[model samples]
Target: MKKQDTLSPYIHFDRKDWAELRSSTPLTIDEDDIKELKGLNDELNIEEIVDIYLPISRLLHLHASATRELYESRNVFLQTNVKKVPYIIGIAGSVAVGKSTMARVLKALISKWPNHPKVDLLTTDGFLYPNEVLKERGLMEKKGFPESYDIAELLHILSDLKSGKGRVEAPVYSHITYNIVPSRTQVINRPDILIVEGINVLQPPKNGGGKEIDQISVSDFFDFSIYVDADEKTIFQWYIERFKLLRGTAFRNPQSYFKKYAHISDEEAFQVAESIWNRINKVNLRENILPTRHRADLILRKGEHHFVESIKMRKI
Candidate 1:
């Protein structure tokens, strides 16, 4: 029981009432028309997305339009400011927490909007340091950890995009290889809206004035940010289930880096999956990842079934 004089604001959105808060503006694209997204951890069907994500996309479309008008006005205000880049949106969350699904959902929904219909989705997995660098630094166990990434390169990409660099290239990662493939890159050419999603995209800036001072995080370039929220147990279960699924699917491919897991029995696979989660992913999630949740503009909280049950937006 605290005093009523506290200035802290209380705001909440009910899962049952999500429909009530939806923008009256009709959805230009039918949810049924949107393709189903297949992710390792979750299956987001068209209906679930239309009810939950379509409205959110509608909001973002409005946001992008308003932002463009403001940017044009500012550009005119400063004749010397010649180039204005795409509005960058950052989505961050723990492993197997459905951030990737959110990115896919938003990308599909936003692309249908009449304004800035061209939407591009990019993942920070491309920004990771090569496997050789991780092995050399003995950081193979800390792969998803912040230090495992080439922050400098990631920053350069974001900076270039924000500065209206018409042609941008991002490294491409092959899930089967579990590594960044050299000479294979994704091209982004003058995209109207860009979505950058990752686990540690929102990590705080480094304080040291060395090589890190110039390293701008993906979050620094984002105009809007979202952080998906869920309890540790739920996310842990999701991670395990996802790992099991991959063992039979992607892990069975001869070219897969995890192909070794295919030989293990179900019990052995489960143990191996839990071992990796306990050692690497869980540590990073609890220490370096979850701490950044407060930095998001909007937080989407999910329940045990992996369904988003509530939303918390930082009070303006």
Candidate 2:
């Protein structure tokens, strides 16, 4: 645990106590639905949902409702008509820490609330510079690193989204091709809630610039945020396992970007995956992702088994 964890401006909760906070929150999704929501090699149990996710979902529901009311009240006070934009929620974490699964599950739960709030999910993988750009910059080996993303473009999209812009288009990233899909875009119109999930979403702006400089970051637009956490060993194991699993699955596809590894034996796949993880993902996590954990509104700390055993929430 970090030193700041025990300090003020935050409230710590064990899993049991947190689960009680769920009290009357209904379980809207079933086991069958969760199966589809889980990421490859990720674990998602109904009990985990009832314990951890439900409470957070309920909390977000209340927050969103309150935010909407405040927005309406401000409009009335000013005696002017203003467009209400969607409440943006940011989710940040390291690779293979079950963050994608958390985002999907949260979307499923939050979208099923009483009013059935319209929820849209946007992953920042699309905001990564196109493959060619990475190659041009000689950063293919640092693909998930902070410097690899198109930060300016990401901030522009967030600015547009927060200003109640209609029909903002986001680039689409393809896993099979490991590149941005040309001519394809995911148009995001206004919704009740928008979940922006990525590894670097919580990063601070004005990197290396003096404190005097004014800057904007994508996180500035978030109404709420979450950081998924797990030990390095656990995440490393998960990543390697995911790579091995994909060898027999996604990697085998003829058009797969990793098709070259599809026929590699288990030992070879493990070694390659380990090398990639040690070189790229680990460094990115240590240098960029993990440092932003303290900036999240909430942190979901997972045990080795991939279940969140505790949560740390910043005081509202």
Candidate 3:
């Protein structure tokens, strides 16, 4: 077992203890929903939902309720009427650590709440600079790094949503093409909640790469944030496993950007996946993603079998 973080500000909970917190939070989902919500190569059983994600849904719902009450109180004090914005949730983690799966699960669970039936999820991949733009900036190798994203645009979209914009558009990204689709966009109307998932959503201002920086940041818009974490070695193995699965599936598509990998021998696939992870994904995790883990409002630490072994919630 990994040693506890002695000086950490978070109140930690073991799986069994955390499971106890799910008291009376109705089990709104079942195995069928789990099979749909989980991502490729990820695991999600009914117990995990009852123990881990149910408590999480309960917490987020409570927080959102409190926030709405506070907003209404402010209106009473100021004697002015303003709209209540959607509660934004930021999910951050290294590649292949199962953050995406958790995001989907949370969105599904939270939407089951009566007051927050309309939930929307948006991933930051669409905010990445298009392949052409990255090629021009010589940042194709740094695709998931902070510098490779259009931070300004992401910030604008979040700002608009927070200001209660009725409709906002985010670009569409195609994993098959491995690039942003120029002609398509996702239109987000008013939602009771929004889940924004990405590797670096919790990142502080870089104040580098010749970019503009200020007191405000992407995370500032988040009412609650989560970081999915595991040991680097564990994450690396998961990445390789997911890559192999993709090679057999998505890579076989003629339009896949990685089609060449589809026919490669198993040994060759391992080497290529290893090289990509080492050169790009691992470096990004070490330097950019993992460093922001402490900034999260909660941390979900997964064990070797890809199950959340423990949780750490920031103390109030």
The order of the candidates by lDDT, greatest first, is 3, 2, 1
Residues 1-316, model 2: lDDT tens digits = 2224545777888888899899799999998998899988988889999999999998998899899899889889999777868999999999999878998999999888989888899999998898899999999999988789987777878888778887789999999999999999998888879999999999888656654323667799999999999999999999999999999889988999999999899999999999999899999999999999999999999998899988888986
Q: For candidate 1, give the lDDT.
A: 0.80
Best by lDDT: 3
Backbone clash total for model 1 is: 0
Candidate RMSDs in Å, in order, are 3.0, 2.5, 2.1
Q: What is the lDDT of residue 198 in candidate 3?
A: 98
CA lDDT of every candidate: 0.80, 0.89, 0.91
lDDT at position 102, candidate 3: 96
Which regions of candidate 1 are displaced past 4 Å? 1-10, 25-35, 211-215
Q: Relative to the unseen true structure, what is the C-alpha lDDT of residue 96 in candidate 1, on a scale of 0 to 100?
A: 94
Clashing pairs counted in every model: 0, 0, 0
Residues 214-245, candidate 1: write the lDDT tens digits.
54566888988889889998898898888888
Model 1 earns a TM-score of 0.92
Q: Could you estimate the TM-score for every candidate?
A: 0.92, 0.95, 0.96
